[model samples]
Target: MRLSSFFMPTLKETPTEAQIVSHRLMLRAGMIRQTSAGIYAWLPLGYRVLRKIEQIVREEQDAAGAQELLMPTIQSAELWRESGRYDDYGKEMLRITDRHDREMLFGPTNEEMITDIFRSFVKSYRQLPLNLYHIQWKFRDEIRPRFGVMRGREFLMKDAYSFDIDAAGARRSYQKMFLAYLRTFARIGLKAIPMRADTGPIGGDLSHEFIILAETGESGVFCHKDWMNLDVLKDAPGMEDDLQPFFDRITSIYAATDEKHDPANSPVPESDLVSARGIEVGHIFNFGTKYSKPMNAVVAGPNGESVPVEMGSYGIGVSRLMGAIIEASHDDNGIIWPDAVAPFNVGLINLKSGDAETDRVCAELYAKLEAAGLEVAYDDRDERPGAKFADMDLIGVPWQLVVGPRGLKNGVVELKRRATGEKEELPVEAALAKLLG
Candidate 1:
């Protein structure tokens, strides 16, 4: 992609309404534009990052043995009514009426809808351990939507619903999703700590929220200091393997959101406790028969008895992760995107755009990088060197390749790593090799 043809409308000053660094940076970087009170239009750069995040979540869900499917944003109100949550869901639910005057809603979640789908076709215990998931847009008219996408009225989410025949099967499904969440966040360069959390309206007896510690986070969390050093991905259990031991190892540690924290009853000593503000990135629930029982989503058991399938729902805030990642990874300049979620792998800058030698060198490097399966954003515009550097940094590409007449004359170019601010002057070939490696 060439900057000359790119539609990034970067701003020089921060918007007053943006209270958080992620919101401000996203606006100035031209990644997203607010189209309404709480809704946003993700621009080209933002959409790329969003899709990358979505794909990571999708891959992790697949690895956990969940099948993918699409669900509609609008749902029949009758489903929610059957689940006894239409009115209980409160003002957040966007109730609607169709042309035929039938009740409908822009679904905030899909538990009711998914239950209906399950009971429609799945009739026996043979399809017991099925998990279905989808990545889709959702709306929940937040009364006070703020902090950009972090608390937006509309957002993208990856929600997976699990159906099992009994409590034991449901627990296994929950453990699988817990492990999947850990791996998903790690792949996105985040160390998300799983903490006991309230199930809220989802009405689950067992629930966990995966949170990333950040100074700008909205909620306070307490956990054992050892959580900082534990890497859940170090020895991941197989999908079909019994995961109780793995689950026990993680949940044994003391970790909780403020609502669940009890200092006096905590097992970990106060000296070993770490308190910090954290942003929630993912949540998983083992709801037993919460949705299935209420909606009469039953299947025949092995004994030929009708039974409500045990169910669990797992959610990862696909769009909110953009803000959470920025909160955890950015510096004073702008966002410091992780390599896995960066929109482009490299930013190629022709410091002297019109200079024949500099342009030739940058063009060659860009082509070589692309050929090596890298995504490159070439700044071919006639802009000042400082302006080009600032824009590239703001957009947060993992690497920046600088080419200038002086560097070209010396048969070398500059390669800079965005995260570490490390720079090396090397031959074009050497730079390409380093980047590829």
Candidate 2:
């Protein structure tokens, strides 16, 4: 993509309303724009990153044996009533009435609706251990929505519902989601620690919140220092395998959100404890028959007895992750995007855009990079070198290739790594090889 044709409206100064680094940077970088309080319109650059994160979450869910299906944003109030939560869900639920005088709502979550779906077609234990998920928009009317997309009232989410025949099967489903969440976050270049957390409105005894530590996090957390060393993806268990041991290894460590932490009851010594602020990126719940039982989502057992299917729900904040990642990864310059989620793999900078030699070199490099299966954003506008560099850094492509008349005359160009701020002067061929490799 060429910057000359791109529609990134970057700002030179920080917006006064942005209280966090992620919020401020996102605005200054022209990734998103606020349409209302706690709601945003994702600009071109922002949408690219959002889709990348969504794909990662989708891939991991598929790997864990979960099937994908999209659900609607608007839900019937009758479904919530079946689960006995329509009245109890409080003001956050965006209740509305259609012209036909039927009550409706923008779903904050899909537990009730999914249960209704299960009860409709799934009749016997033959379809047990089924998992269905979707990536869709959700809305919750937050009383005080702030911090940009981090606390947005409207956001994108990936919610997966798992149905099993018994408590044992439910636990296995939960474990698979647990492992899947770990792998999903890692692939996005985040080290998310799974910590025991409150189920909140989801109403589950077994729950875990995947948190990424950041100074701008919304909540405090305590965990063992050893958590930093564990790689849940290494030698991961297959979907059909018994995941008990793998689950046990992760939950054995001391980890808790501030709401669940008890210093006196902690198994890890205080000397070995590491406390930090963390942003919640994903959550999973093993809610037995919470939704199924209330909604009468029953299936026939092997013994021919009617039983409510045990169920679990897994959620990853698809939109909120953009903010969480920025909080954890950005520097004073701007966002340093991870390679897997970056808007483009490389930024091609022509220091002298109108110069015949510089333009020729950059155009050639851009074509080579794109042919190598790379996403390149070529800065072809007639802008100052400093402005071009600033914009590239602010948008946070992983690598930047700088071409100028002087460098072209010398038969060399500069390659810079965004994350490490490392630079190397190499021949055009050498730079292409390094980037492709």
Candidate 3:
């Protein structure tokens, strides 16, 4: 993509309303723009990152044996009523009435609707152990929506529902999802620690919130220092293997939000405890028969008895993850995007754009990089070299390949790594090879 034609409207100064690092950086980097209090329009650059994160979540869900499906954003009020939560869900739910005078709502979550869907076609234990997932937009009317997409009222989410015949089967599904979340965050260059969480009115001990530690996080957390060194992607068990040991190993790690922390009775010693702030990015609940039983989503058992199918709901904040990533990865200049989630693999800069030799070298390198199956952002605009460098750093592409008349005359180009701020001058061929590798 060429910067001159790209629709990224970057700002030179920070917006006063943005209180957090992620929110401020996102605005100045031209990743997103606030349309309302908490609603945002993702611009070209931001949209690319959003889609990349969504794809990663989708791939991880698929690898865990979940089938993908689409669900509507608007839902019937009758469904929530049947699940006994319409009245209890409170003001966060955006309730509305259609012209037909029928009650409707922009769904905050999909438990009730998914249960209704399950009971419609799935009957008997034959379809047991089924997992259905979707990536869609959701809305909740936050009283004080702030911090950009981090606390947005409208956001994209990936929610999956798992149905099993009994508690034992449900536990296995939960374990699979547990490992799946670990691998998902790890792939996105985040070390998310799973901590036990409250199940709320649904009432179950089988609940966890996956949190990533960041200085700008909202919730204070306490965990074992060992969590810092554990590489979940390297050590996680296979999806089909016995996951009990892996599940136990992860849950046994002393990690808890401040609300759940008990210092007097904690197992970890003082020296090993790492108290820090964290952001919750994903949550999984193994709420047996909570939605199914209330909504009468039953199926015939092997013994020919009617039984309520055990259900679990897992959710990952697809859009909020963008802010979380920025919070965890950015430096003073701007966001330091992870390689897997970066919008472009490389930023190609023609330091002297009007110079024939500089343009020729940059264009050649851009073509070669693209031919090697890389996403390259070529800055072909008539801009100053300093402005080009600053913009490249702000958008946080993993690498910046710099070409200038002086460098071209010397038969070399400059390659800089965004995250490490390290640069090397080499022949154009060598630079291309390094980027490809």
RMSD of each: 0.9, 0.9, 0.9
Off by over 4 Å in 1: none
**C-alpha TM-scores of all predictions:** 0.99, 0.99, 0.99
**Model 1 agreement with the true structure over 1-437: per-residue lDDT tens digits:** 99999999999999999999999999999999999988999999999999999999999999989999999999999999999999999999999999999999999999999999999999999977999999999999999999999999999999999999999999999999999998899999999998887899998899999999999898989989988888777776887888999889988888888877888897778899999999999999989888888899999999999999999999999999999999999998898999999999999999888888887778888888899899999999999989999999998999999989988889899999999999999999998899999
Instruction: Name the TM-score of candidate 1.
Output: 0.99
lDDT of each residue in 337-375, candidate 2, tens digit only: 999999999999999988988888888889889998999
Q: In model 1, how large is the Cα lDDT of residue 230?
A: 85
- State, as a TM-score between 0 and 1, how close model 2 is to the true structure: 0.99
Q: Regarding lDDT, does 2 or 3 come out ahead?
A: 2
lDDT for each candidate structure = 0.93, 0.94, 0.92
Worst 10 residues of 2 by lDDT: 230-239
Query: What is the alpha-carbon lDDT of model 2 when measured against the actual structure?
Result: 0.94
What local lDDT does model 1 show for residue 197? 77
